[model samples]
Structures are given as C-alpha cells and as structure tokens.
Target: MTTVGFLYPGHFAEDEFPRMEVILDTTIRLVVNRTEPGEDDRRPDTLRTLGEPERLAAGVEELRRAGVESVVWASTGGSFVYGWEGAHGQTTALARAAGLPASSASLGFVQAVRALGAARVAVAATYPEEIARLFSEFLAAAGIDVVATHSGGVTTAAEAAAWGPDRLKELAVAADRPEADAVLLPDTALHTTAHICDLEELLAKPVLTANQVTVFEALRLARRRTWAPQLGTLFAAREAPPAPVGWRPAGE
Candidate 1:
C-alpha cells in the first residue's frame, strides 16, 4: 500500500480524507495529522501563520510514525495566500521538516488543472472576494486563466464546513462560465468528496475540489496511480506515470 500523509490545518473537513479512503478502496492509504488551529480568518497574515513551516513541522512526527511515504499540507487558503513562490517554498520547507515529499492544496489544484488539460477555469471559493482573488492570481502565475469567479464571502472555516450540498452546488453553478474549461472549488474546509461526481454532473464539466486534488497530489508524491470514478474527472482520467521525485508543477 502507498501511504500518504496529510498535514491538515484545524478540524474542519479533515474527515473527507478518510471518506475518500473508503471510497477509493485501493492500496493507497491516507493518514492525516491535524495542525493546531489558528485564527479563522483568511487574511494574508493569518494564513501565513496557518501555513507556517513551524506549524506544519510540529505535525510531522505523527505522520512519520504512521509510515507515510508523502505529506500534503491540506489547506488551500493557507497555501495560496502565500503567493506562488512562497507557497512553493512552504512545501519545500515542509518536505525538509517531514523528511518526505510534500505538497499543498494550492499546488495540487494547479497540477490537477493541468492534468485535465485545462487552461482556463472558474473559481467557486468560500473565502471573501479578496482572498479568492489571491487564488486567481496564484493560478495565473501557473499559466491557468480564471475566466470567472464567485466568492461565498464566508469568513471562517467553521462557517464553510457548515455548507451543505445545496450551497455547494449553487456556488459552482453560479461560478461556471461557458468559456471556462472547469470549475474549481478551492477550500479544504468545504466537504466535497461525497459530492464530486454530482458536482461535475451538475456542471457538465470537471469539478476540481480542494480535498480531491489534495489527495491526488499526495498520491502523485507517493508515485501511485488510482482509478476512482467516484472522485470525479481528475481521478477517472488515466494519469501519466508519476513525475520524478523532485518534480514541481510548471510554475514552481
């Protein structure tokens, strides 16, 4: 079995990892270690602390004991708020601290978008407009264009975690534009694994959710491939061989 570790921030939506493991039913093992909760706001400063190398490093021993082959910092806002270069450095630092391959949700989205051969996408974010815009900027740096964006104005992970299927579908439908290649939901706090296929079907396009790509990235780092149609188009598509050990997606 390929064991991947997830260093998740706070308590919200980490359950999605185990839920995914159950759905995937593959040799891939998802082991999550929760980092201490920080201020719930999405401000740049707050997010910087949330994704701090020290905070991520503090959780390394738990994952190491779990025998994880790779580690992922599974918080989209925390990572993207750092900007592209900083986010790359964040993963590098985490990998060094964990003594294992490391990636984060923001980077995962970029790789997932490229893997789907999509250049343009629509963002459906639960963060406020400003924070959501940062994600758009981050994607642009990676050569992905944001055709449209819809922000939910949710201020905290607690609020986002409370969002149910109806709200998620509404946000995705509102965010999608005909010109976009796929719709992205970039909040790890949002519960989405059980609804990925439904969201894609509803939009008639690929729906790349934060937790989904996070897991996909962890698997990529572990040099493992899986076929899980239930997880939506990213997982259903035949993936190429895992990139080399130190591979960073194009703009890193």
Candidate 2:
C-alpha cells in the first residue's frame, strides 16, 4: 500500500486529512507539531518556527519509522512565508531526514500549476494583503505569472480552516481573471479537497487549493500516477513531476 507522511501543525484542521485520504485513495500518515503563536503566534512569520532544524527532523523521523513512501511538509504558510529559497531548504531537510522523496504544500502549488500545463495563474488567499503577497512572490520566483489575486485578510490559520464554500467560492470568483488558466487558493488551513471540483466548474478554470495539491505533489514525488477527476486536472495528467527538493545543510 502506498502511503504519504505529512508534518502538520497542531492547529491545522485535522478533520480534512481523513477525507483527503478517502478522496485521493491513499494512506496519509501525519506527525502533528505545535505551532507557537507568539504574542501574536497566529501571524505569518510564526510559520518560520516550524522549519527549525530539530523540530522538523523529529517529525521526519517519525514518518521514517512508519515507512511512508514520501514526506510532505503540509503547511503552506509555514514554508511560503520563508520565501522560495527558504521553502526549498525546508523540503530538502525533510527528504533527507525521512530518507525518502519529499515535498511541501507551499511548493506543491508551484508543481501543481506547471503539471497542468498552466503558466498564468490567479491567487485567492485567506491572508491579509502583505501575507498574500508573500505567496504571490513565492509563485513568481517559480516563473509563474500571477494575473490576479484576492485577499480575505483572515488573520489566523485556525480561522482560515473554518471557512466554508460561500467564502471560498467568492474568493475563487474574485481571483479569476481572463488570462488565468488556473486559480489557486494558497492556505493549507482551509479544508478544500471536497469542494475542488465544484469550484472548478464555477470558475470554468482549473482550481488548485492548498490541501488538494499537497497530496498530489507527494504522490508525484513518489512517482505515483493518480487521476482524481473530481479533484481537478492536477491529478489526472501524467506529466513529469517537479524535481524532488534535495537536501542541503543550512549555509551550504
């Protein structure tokens, strides 16, 4: 049986994992870590705490013992807020620690968009304008052109996770632009797997969300071909997966 290991924050919406496993038809083994919301731990910079060497290695070791085929650093903000190069370093550290292939939800959005053969994209984030811009910058560094964006100004990861279809649909529509081949909602805290297909229909464009792409990116790193027509085009196509993020010791 193929299995994917995920390292997530204690505050992420846990209910979605079981459903994502059911929808994607893969086993998801998770290692939940504490996200210390400093005086304002809920803020984006706090995400950097999760990538600290010792903390991340511990989670990766747990998945190694369980024998997950791949590891995914499943926090979008945690890595993206670190910038593109920083996100790469985090996933690389995870792969080396797990001694297997690896990826992250933040980087997963980049892979998912390209795998669908899309170069132009739109972003609908639950963050404030500044935080949302960070996600946009992360994507741009990957050579993806962001045609439009919508920020919900939702302050904390917990609040972002609780949003329902009404908010998600509104964001998707607002972010959709004529030039975009796809729309991306870039917050891992949001529960998005179940609603991906419906939103794609509503926007008339491929919709890739934090949770959906995270799973697929791990599967791709495992070199697994998965086609969840319900989840959107990212799953069904057999395109070349992104190069697995390689391990680099800090300051190397």
Candidate 3:
C-alpha cells in the first residue's frame, strides 16, 4: 500500500481530509504538530511562525517509521522561507531524513502553475496582505506573473483550518482578475481543493490551491498517475509521471 504523509499545524480545514481520502484512495495519513501561534495569535491573522527545521526533520522521521512512502509539508508559509532553493533543499533534507520522497505546499504551487500553463495568475490568500508580497516574489522566481491578489487576513492556523469552504470560494471569486487565465488560493489551511472544479466553472479558468497542488506534486514525484475532478485541472491533465529513482527535489 502506498502511503502519503502530511505534516501540518494542529488544525486544518475539515473538508481537506475527506477530499484527500477520496482522491488518494485511503492512502493518506495525516500527521500533525502544534499550531505554535506566537504573540499575534488572533482570529484573523496571517503572521506565521516558521517552524524549526530540526523539529520538522524529527517529525518526518516519525512518519517514515509509520511506513509513509512520501511526505508533504501541509503549511504554505512554513515551507516558503528558503525561497526556491530553500523550498527545494528543505524537502530534500526531509526526504533524506525520512528515507522517503518529500514536497511542500509552496513548491507544489509553482509546479501546478506550470502544469496549467498559466502565465499570469490572480492569487487569493488567507494570510495578511503583507505575506502576500512574499508569495508574489516566490512565484516570480518560478516565472509566474501575479496579475492580482486579495488577502483575508486570517490570523491563526486554527482559524484558517476552521474557515468554511463557502467563505473561501467567496474570497477566490472576489480576488480573481479579468486579465488572469488562472486563479490560485495559496494556503493549505484554507481548504480550497474540493472547490476547484466549482471555482473553474464559476470563473471559466484553472483554479489551484496549496493542498491540491501539494498532493499532485508528491504523486508525480512518486510516479503515480492520479486524475481527480474534485482536485482540479492540475490533476485532470494527463502527463507522464516523474522518473522513478531520481526524483529531483521540489522547486528544482
């Protein structure tokens, strides 16, 4: 049985687990850590504390012991710190530590944009407006143009996890731009994957979210071909799986 392990904060969208289970066919096991909200722990905040790499590395080791075949960082902000190289290096490090393949939300977002052939995109974020700037730079490095952005200023990881899917769709529609060919919701905690097909129908374009891309990217790395309408266009497209035994780290 192939296994995918997700490392994340204490809370997350209730919708994500069900979606993952159906898409991955009961191959997913969610492993969680503390929320670790710092001084700015509020209901509507986006300031995320960078989790210690040492702590994350240890967590990956535990997942490996549980027979996980691949691991994914389920938090967007936590994995975006090292920029492109940082994101790649961190996943490689975790893969080495766990003796399994690995990936992250941010790096996966880049791949999804490319898979969709999206040149200019509008991003809807669950983070504060300030954090949106960081993602814009990260996407630029990946050769994606940020045509527009909107932030909901969600403060805590718990709150982001608790946010309703209907509300998130509203944010995505509000954040979309007429000029963009695609829309991205860049927070794993926001639970936007299950709504991707709906969003596409509404906006008439590709819709991507962190968790959806994260899973797709990992499956690609593992040479697994997955197609799920609920997960959106990235998965809907048919492409050759990544070469086995030489999975380049994410963002490479």
Off by over 4 Å in 3: 25-49, 240-252
Per-residue accuracy of model 1 over 15-84 as CA lDDT, tens digit each: 9999999878578789998999788887878988898888899999999999999999999988998999
Clashes (N, CA, C under 3 Å) per candidate: 0, 2, 3
Instruction: List TM-score per model, in order.
Output: 0.94, 0.87, 0.82
Clashing pairs in 1: none
Could you tell me the TM-score of candidate 3? 0.82
Clash number for model 3? Answer: 3
Minimum summed lDDT over a 10-residue window in model 2 is located at 243-252
Q: Is candidate 1 or candidate 3 better by TM-score?
A: 1
RMSD of each: 5.8, 7.7, 6.6
Candidate 2 clashing pairs, residues 3+ apart or interchain: 37-41, 38-41
* Worst 10-residue lDDT window, candidate 3: 243-252
Ten-residue stretch with the least lDDT total in model 1: 243-252
Identify the candidate with maximal lDDT. 1
Give the TM-score ranking, best first.
1, 2, 3
Each model's lDDT comes to 0.89, 0.75, 0.69
Best by TM-score: 1
Q: What is the alpha-carbon lDDT for the whole of candidate 2?
A: 0.75
- lDDT computed for candidate 1: 0.89
